[model samples]
Target: MGSTVNMQKQTDKVNLFETQMTMPPTSEKGSSGNVPEDDPSFNPFGFVTDNPSSRSAIQLPETPAEDGNVGQMLYRTEDKGREFGSTIKSGKLRWFVRETGSKESRRGTVVFLHGAPTQSFSYRTVMSEMSEFGFHCYAPDWIGFGFSDKPQPGYGFNYTEKEYHEAFDKLLDTLEINSPFFLVVQGFLVGTYGLTWALKNPSKIEKIAILNTPLTVSSPVPGLFKQLRIPLFGEFTCQNAILAERFIEGGSPYVLKNEKADVYRLPYLSSGGPGFALLETAKKINFGDTLGQIANGFSSGSWDKPTLLAWGIADKYLSQSIAEEFEKQNPQNVKLQLIEGAGHLPQEDWPEKVVAALRSFF
Candidate 1:
């Protein structure tokens, strides 16, 4: 009887996916300046930095380690044909992806974007739930994070915004995930980058949701963000397991058990000890400059696509007011909702709220 009920629910989810894909765009209004032009001077990601040192790739198998802890067990569940662990090459870089769901039903895809420090692993719960609901999901670890390649400053791997953008584009191109799909972005930094991409390729995106992310420059940068960007201190913190664990717990609000936190810690201490790469990415972040440009772009930009701002009130890094203000500035096609009791990592803290928001918003 239990199996029967589960099967019935799966069928219902498949039907729901069919309904969602058939839905029309939020507005017939055409996009204008918001679409990024391929000008020679236009850099989608803010800046470029060069590392004169050489670099090498860590050859991670296309699979999650079977010997992982509880967090890994929870996040890495295989769903027959729906489960995936793969890699896509973008120039000299290789991206790591933990994806699920299927295109067999013809329902659209859903892309999950994670923030700094944390890799695509942040979206494991959300991706699992969404995939179960019958939407194809793709969560890729950024070039420097997760199982992806990590280029040391010694190896000419100066992590830059432009490199991130290019690698992301190349990953999607390699996987052939076009627009008309849902995009869920977490954290302020990744949200700024993802939003810029979405605004440029609005036609490809059916809907977008920003969660616990910095959409406006209203809030001050969290101390954790600042600390992680400090010269030697930042590198030391990222490399030190104890400090890194403390950093994750401080931002999470809810306590993370040692075992679970270890799962989150794995990528940082992976094959080449790439924790410093995260620090490199963090150092390049200038939220004041980045958020200002985003706010300005969205204000005058023409984007009629449906957008949802789902913020976790307990998030210490980003204030809830940023979400509210963002919706106010672009209320015409935007909606703001707060998730109670969840922090910066809402999906980990409150997966149900995150899942429900995605269900309704899309």
Candidate 2:
């Protein structure tokens, strides 16, 4: 209760959108490559580009594909608003939730938390496959990312570490998404945030699996992520469809298929772009301080829960030594698995291997 109140007070401390970020000056400047910006169906807020010259951004599909993939579903007002009424009632966000597997044949529930700039769409294939193995999987696009509500600055969303953790906790409570579920956390801030939450609510978590997320600052920030935190350049890259596409491609050792890449792009481009949300989220990342807190949280407490550190050897952003040392320190219950030929987004690059790792862990 104290934490909840503290988080609320923190939210009141800042004006999220005081920094002025304007849309590209002209329709030609607005388009991301060959993707038409002036189309009648175009949503300026949907996909974006910082590249003033039409040469740089990737050309995204004019419209989303019609065929529905497995576990693809939108959050209707009645279904998602049941417990967390305020989030839905605000009308600023209609969060997306993806699920696979049935309770009847469920082995266990696995909650997947994606990192910044990416939603649950990152785990679509992984979740569907895990369902075949008898595990019920759930992945939600965190408030700002994915199809969730992207509240601009003046509205209430602060996009802080505390805010995200609180929002996720409230979502679980409101939905009655009980514990005894495995938590798979991706990226740095998210990994730390989820770890802290699991430590406090140990009863709910079955195990913890971390992928390409550094728990300390010894690892340098990747160039792409670093750019996201820079002022004008960061904002430009964050909203640019080409840069985003390149980041995704570079993060993985495997080539991403066209359709899958589009899925990742749609959310950021949705509604004239979630640039404000992206910038707010990037500003919260303080590796030196935050990583220390996470390391302390893991070290000071007795983490008897099983933890798996799956590192991608080819990852340019996160260091492999950190993962090695983490497992070295906790040999009793922690296991470090190096995923070869995989980069940051292992789920996308090597879903088969990722699935195998989960199955073995369970």
Candidate 3:
């Protein structure tokens, strides 16, 4: 999974890109409010020094090896049982698996699914916190995001509902993670796919924690996302890297902050980032029937698993009113907890609240 450090560094680079676009190469020092730290091109912020101590609690992992790998090679090597790597079966895709906690202290595992245009990096803080709570957190970067192999256009990317479900099941099997674990999902990742999976295999999920996630078609969908659901224009706009960047920036509250925005942009800067799978997600967005099926499945009482809704009050994409409605509808089954001062990505905005809520549930 991607870390905070990688995101920050990439964001800084993006800021530099913006600077270069606005200023000439031979511009004088501090002309565009850009100042150097270790190198002329490296600026953490416009005027402040880029110091490590000033970074947020979520530290970035060390830079990967020069082989263009995204995570530790040993985690993927055959000697390590190919734990963290890609494997395809039945036309379904499975990605990395990082096993945490010892067998003796294995409280329970958490299968975390991340949101759109992101990989497991979105759950880095949550994963770390869960680890501390003695849960074996098994988070995977989905097939099209993070370190996984990005299939050529038309070969993959536009994944069907069945394909996503099968891929997730295969991933769990590949990693030997059986049932009775908590299912933690966020954003678009869980709305239909994760919820459907949980409904179909309710016995496997102990409890479900949804963080600022939209569960139904009626739930609020961002305007840009709504546009991306269109046909020709949708496909055209989704393919544009600039548009993707803009969407990401708009979704994020810290896009203007140097440290935070950097972390958010790393995976996008990575090869094969946010182009194909994002389009597929948008396409799936317009398929209201599928989302309805998921909602219906949940409403059918198929899921006996305990449900917790930890919503960030400040989330722009998903309105708090939805959470209120959810609680009003499922008063007995769902517990809603509001997280103050957090946006759509609560783990980034308020890690402590996310951690505390999970701890209370788990």
Candidate 4:
């Protein structure tokens, strides 16, 4: 969700944390590089920034008051979300999670997984609305994003697909989410990781709901991600504070209000952890490889779980046709619900419609 903004303005922004660490070498592939040997992260091709910036702790500062209206204290920027959330210790990572409804709720359990450059914050309204329907809902910011612990890559946690899946599994086990539960996944890299996770553990999933994530090889990679794959450029892209705002607005027909936009920029402004985490993740994923796995894994015969394509027709990144094509492959189990006015981040662009669709489908 990182955006393209002037470097000067970004530096002028207030510093949120005062932390430091030794850089790490390249994680998986391309361990050899011609870059200077003095670089803390030795590999020449590593996405490690020339100089890692300061970052704040996992705890957030005082909440901003909700002066406007859209109901339910949107985006979890206020006290409603602060006191409602708690940190869960899962292995070496600490996950910041937002819970709604009691764990014993009868309707069923729903685990919400958000995509990169964003956090569980996007699911604030959807989870809130869904909880009122008597379902237990939990949305955790993925490792290295949001209020969750952002471990340095090659440190305790690497941002590889395998690592993400493993971390997520541990988190689920820690939360005692053993019962087959409904899974809602959206966005890129980590978002698609959610789908791949479900594919690997089909027995653990009751039903699957997909948002505007890359489902096929045809799904386009946004410029932000593509740009972040570049050597020097990727480092700069990770530091941008308005990544979420630019990503959402770039694909939508409307602009985000100041209030809503702040929620998205809050993390990036406060620390360099989330942004650097995104950079490492972007560099690790081979879109073609991942998309191929998603397309073929969820194809008709292999996938038996009930699926919902609650897609946003207005998504400039992945068009409505992607959903239509996916539905055709699994006609019996996959249901496509096209949301007319929503765009790339439908949960943020049009949550009411997303909630309604989830209500009917879940």
Candidate No. with top lDDT: 4
Instruction: Give the runs in model 1 whose Cα sits over 4 Å from its true position.
Output: 1-84, 154-157, 242-244, 271-273
The clash count of every prediction, one per candidate, is 7, 11, 6, 3
lDDT, each prediction:
0.64, 0.62, 0.59, 0.76
lDDT, candidate 4, 36-71, per-residue tens: 457453444221111112112112121112122223
Positional deviation of 238 in candidate 1, in angstroms?
Answer: 2.7
Of the pair 3 and 4, which is ahead by TM-score? Answer: 4
What is candidate 3's lDDT per residue for 1-362, written digit by digit as tens? Answer: 22222232322222323333443343353353433346535523321112122122223222112122323222333142223334444234536544455444467778887766555655666677677788888767666665555565467545666667877777777666775888888767434577777878887888999887776667766776676677777666655433433444455444334334333344444444456666666675444765666556655254456788888887767788877776665667788999876667676566778889988987
User: How far is 311's C-alpha from truth in model 4 (Å)?
Assistant: 0.8
- Quote the positional error of residue 118 for candidate 4 in Å: 0.7
- Backbone clash tally for model 3? 6
Q: Each candidate's TM vs. the true structure?
A: 0.73, 0.72, 0.71, 0.78
Kindly indicate the candidate among 1 and 3 with the higher TM-score. Answer: 1
Better candidate by TM-score, 1 or 4: 4
Candidate 3: the clashing residue pairs are: 5-60, 7-262, 7-263, 8-262, 8-263, 11-262
Query: Which lDDT tens digits does candidate 2 get at residues 6-119?
Result: 111111111111111212233444353433546665545432322112222122232322122222312211132122112232233466677778655568888888876666
Which parts of model 2 have CA positions greater than 4 angstroms off?
1-93
lDDT value, candidate 1, whole model = 0.64
RMSD of candidate 3 to the truth, in angstroms, is 8.9
